[model samples]
Target: MTTPIHVMSEIGKLKTVLLKRPGKEVENLTPEIMERLLFDDIPHLSVIQKEHDAFAQALIDRGVEVLYLEKLSAEAIDAGNYKEKFVERILDESNLETKPVREGLKKYLLSFDTQEMVDVIMAGVRKKDVTIESNHLSDISEEEVYPFFMDPMPNLYFTRDPAAAMGDGLTINHMAFEARNRESLFMEVIMDHHPRFAGQDVSVWRDRNHTSRIEGGDELILNDKVLAIGISQRTSAKAIEDLAIELFDNNSNFEKVLAIKIPNVRAMMHLDTVFTMVDYDKFTIHPGIQKNNGEVDTYILEKGEKPGTVKITHRSDLQEILREALDVPKLTLIPCGGGDAIIAAREQWNDGSNTLAIAPGVVVTYDRNYVSNDLLRRHGIEVIEVASSELSRGRGGPRCMSMPLVREDLPAR
Candidate 1:
């Protein structure tokens, strides 16, 4: 039996991946609440969908199986005969205040077929969309300013966040923000009930019901035995420790975890935002995450001599650490925007460093970051550029938008 979820390294040849195409959810963003929704600007739905299609096509051209999250959610529910249960769970988390409103909303949602219901959920329900017959003051209150009965999941297109596929398993994340917290539920349902995954032995290294927060954007599979995670705005330190303990005790191939701490700011929200592996000995790094002396806080975790514990070592030199982890004599850190402060800052904001490696020495990137793209070409990397005008508005590049499911193992370097 072939493993359904196997991601041994970041730079391996991509065999399968998961993506969420931009939908009505992008059009649901309004200027007033855009910031709270984690979007700087609203995207033109048609254009964003076109760009997203091109991204999917690029992967398809390279023989990668592209799975859509929205389609999968619907399939899982229908296959498992879980439509009512799914609707109940969704409403339970949507913060629909009153019982009347909740019941009305449930009826409204159930009216749609399974696929349409999933799409409607992603697009969100406006207060005016559902008819509520409540004379209660709370229902008729002066809350006209707020628009949604259910908030739009503007970040759903960034399929990389809700969960991460590790070696033969995955972590259904407890996302950091309320806006994205419910997104992981789709993954949970798919893994637990979908025909393709239900009977599979896909390990849930960490489930989403925990109090501690962790986002998939912060998780990185450096190699079969080494994992790099970010302690950033989205992932708490406690969560990383918890994950480390689980991996160590479960006989997982992962033996060491590098907890790299970056500034917990939105600009560089996750380690992948500022750092990502590109080739066997190459990585793209945004200079903003480093100190003046080129140092960043990093901790090395390994199985402890005592049971139920992990040994930790404080480290600062990222370059040396990478070379050692990958068993290479030398490693190269390619600075985004060619090490220019002004260009790097501007391009980094557009995700110049977040390149998705489909295979060693080959990557997919945003065409808008010309300076970074040109620099990558100069270094002998096969750089495939995709249109980014609408997609960039979401502040994610190829890496942020993709979730690799399976990759061919890299032979010993």
Candidate 2:
């Protein structure tokens, strides 16, 4: 088996990446369940799958290995005793304990390879009639019922937000909201106990008393020596600080840490939603936050006994500080949404700023964000657009669609 390469840089030679194709879970989102599911609207699964396939195929065409989370989960179930544990974890997290629902869950876990189980785990199992054992609850009538059922997981398709790969292992995030907690559980099992991935170190940052959500979408590995973290609505300052301590406490290769504080707005949910590296010295960014036009702040910390600290108003300014502090050459900033007032505003809302680069100057994007694509094209970057109308309906784009585990650094241009 080929050991997966460690991710040391964003603009690296393409290697292996992970993705979860949208499925029935997306179609199960109803207006009443939208908020609970962390989605603003329901997406057409068929169309979303088609779009996802296009994105995956684009990476495959470039010789990058694309691993599907569903296939991995099914394989894990077949290889270890983790299947039952995963099922029980899901049940406990979702608060489903009725007899019928419990039996249904057991059946679903046993059929991990089937579409039914996939749908149930991703889209969520519906509440059926509740029941109790005759001996256990003799006083309760059948009409009175037993435990309540739970809402289905409609946002599991956003796999990028559940777990993040850092250094030599994976970190299972404690999602900021309850709607996506099931995703974290699924990732935790895969990362910690899967036969194919057994023995790999896995970290879980869950506070029994407080929520410290840290999504992969907000974390970026610029180089082996630097990590750029985004603090936004989905990722908190406390979460970032905790992650920093974890990373710094264990690793000596990392020499600096940079935190880019994004505004807590729906438009800016993660750091990748506003910035991504395209090459050794080049990056794509949203001027609003990257330029400090919005209420965003940038901070940096160096490695030493004292561990010097610095703050700047804009990401560009911060970049300069990093270049000088880390002894790197100039950094380039490519504006997202075309850098035009009207176009930038329009595309940014549609997640134009969110992109996953397969290789230097080559990236995947939503076809809906046309203006951003055009801008990338004009700047000599290759754009492969996925038909994301259905996927975008769920409020995520290319960046949210992928979780890169390994990449090779590109030679300086």
Candidate 3:
């Protein structure tokens, strides 16, 4: 039986991918709550959608099949008859004023068809949308003037962070920020209830029930037997340890987990924000991720002598670590913005380093990062540039906006 998910290498030829087109959620960010919503600037909905469509078209033009998260989520709910259960789960997670508010919201949401309900839930339920008769002071009073009954998931456009497809399975993530915590629920529903994957042998390496957070932008499947996870602001070390233990116990082929530590800052919030694999032995790197001497904290995790234990080794030579992991005689680390301090900082903010590799030696990047794009071309890599003037406002690039469900396995040596 063919597995529904098959991603083993970061630079493999992408086959099927999941993407969320910019929706009303893009324009839902208000000045007062934009920061809380994890957006420094709100994108123009029309323009963002145009750019996102162009991005998807580029992928399709390359013989890649693109799927929409919203459509799949709605299908999953309807196929499994999960409308009531879905509403209940959303309400349980939503922090409302009282039971009456919850009941009102549930009823209002249930009134819609599955597709509309999914969109409404993602677009957020504004306070004015629901009417409830509650005697509770909390519900009646104006103590909290928050306009949204449920905050709009503006970051949903970044399909990468919600979940990651590894070898034969995937990890439905528990996001770092509350703003995106519920994002993975959609993927969970898809994997568990969708007709295409309901009974498939898709392994859940690590479910989203844990307290520790892990984001997909920090999870890189280097190869079938090796992975690279970042210990950054969004992904915790404990999460990586637990994932390594789970993988070691279940999957006998997985041999190593490289836990790379980077600065815990918003600019480099994820490993992909500063580092990404572009080719078999080539990678894009933001100079800001390294120290003065080009050292990076990296931990190697493998199976211990005993069951249910992981052996850990700490190393700081990132370049060497990558070379060994990939089994390459030589490695190329292409700096974003051509290693210029000022340009790197400027382009990195727009996710210049976050590139989506569609195939070996071929990647999709933001057209705005001209310096980095030019540098990549000089290194014998084919760069596909897409319109990103509006899309970059989300602080993510092509890689951040896509989640690969299937990638062609690389040829064996």
Q: Each candidate: what lDDT?
A: 0.92, 0.69, 0.92
Best first by lDDT, ranked: 3, 1, 2
Q: How close is candidate 2 to the true structure, as a TM-score?
A: 0.85
In angstroms, what RMSD does candidate 2 have relative to the true structure? 4.1
Give all TM-scores, in the order shown: 0.98, 0.85, 0.98
C-alpha-based local distance difference test score of model 2: 0.69
lDDT (tens digit, per residue) of candidate 3 on 1-413: 45789999998899999999988887889899989888889899999999999999999999999999999999999999999999999877777768888888999999999999999999988878887779877775643677788889989989999899999999999999999999999999999999878888889999999999999999999999999999999999999999999999996357899999999999999999999999999999999988888889999999988878999999998999999999999998999999898999999999999999999999999999999999999999999999998899888899999999999999998
Model 3 misplaced regions, further than 4 Å? 141-144
Error of 2 at 155 (Å): 2.4
Q: Give candidate 1 misplaced runs (Cα > 4 Å).
A: 140-143
Candidate 1 lDDT? 0.92
Output the worst ten-in-a-row residue range by lDDT, candidate 2: 304-313
Using lDDT as the measure, name the better of candidate 1 and candidate 2.
Answer: 1
lDDT score for candidate 3 against the true structure: 0.92
How far out, in Å, is residue 341 in model 2?
3.3
